[model samples]
Target: MNDQTKGIIAWIIIGLIAGLVASLIVGGAGSIIGWLIAGLIGSVVGGFLAQRFDIKLNLGNPFFEQVIVSIVGAIIVLIIAQIIT
Candidate 1:
């Protein structure tokens, strides 16, 4: 696989983890597609919020850090969704 392919796979893995964890924390219908969507969008929002807020998680492993950040972001997304719908 190429570098881009590897990166996409990594993101999917991280997103799955984050989405599952976030859903459990926030209460959501657990589904593969739901998790993927939440995780992907959460990753972007979380990365942006973290940068804007100067929040850096020193989780040692970069992948773990990404998952945690994504989870947090997903939680926020889920909460906003609940409010909207």
Candidate 2:
């Protein structure tokens, strides 16, 4: 697979994981697609926040660190959403 394709697949995987975890934590009753979308958005949010705050996970593995970050972001998004509505 090409680099771009691999990146897309990685993003999707990260999103799915982050979304599911966030749903469980936030008691989400949404659909799979919804979680996926949320997770995707969470990844972006997490990345932005991480960049701004200089957050880094020295877990020796980039993927796992990203998953954690994405999960946190998803949770933040879910919480903010709950408050907004």
Give TM-scores for every candidate, taking all chains together and pairing residue i with residue i.
0.95, 0.93
Most TM-score-accurate candidate: 1
RMSD of 2: 1.0
- Candidate 1 lDDT for residue 53: 99
Q: What CA root-mean-square deviation does each model show from the true structure?
A: 0.9, 1.0
Report model 1's TM-score to 2 decimal places. 0.95
Each prediction's whole-model lDDT (CA): 0.90, 0.90
Q: What 10-residue stretch in candidate 2 is worst by lDDT?
A: 27-36
Error of 2 at 13 (Å): 0.6
In candidate 2, which residue ranges exceed 4 Å CA deviation?
Answer: none
Off by more than 4 A, model 1: none
Over 11-55, each residue of candidate 2 has an lDDT whose tens digit, in order, gives: 999999999999999967388897898799899899889989999
lDDT of 2: 0.90
Clashes of 2: 0
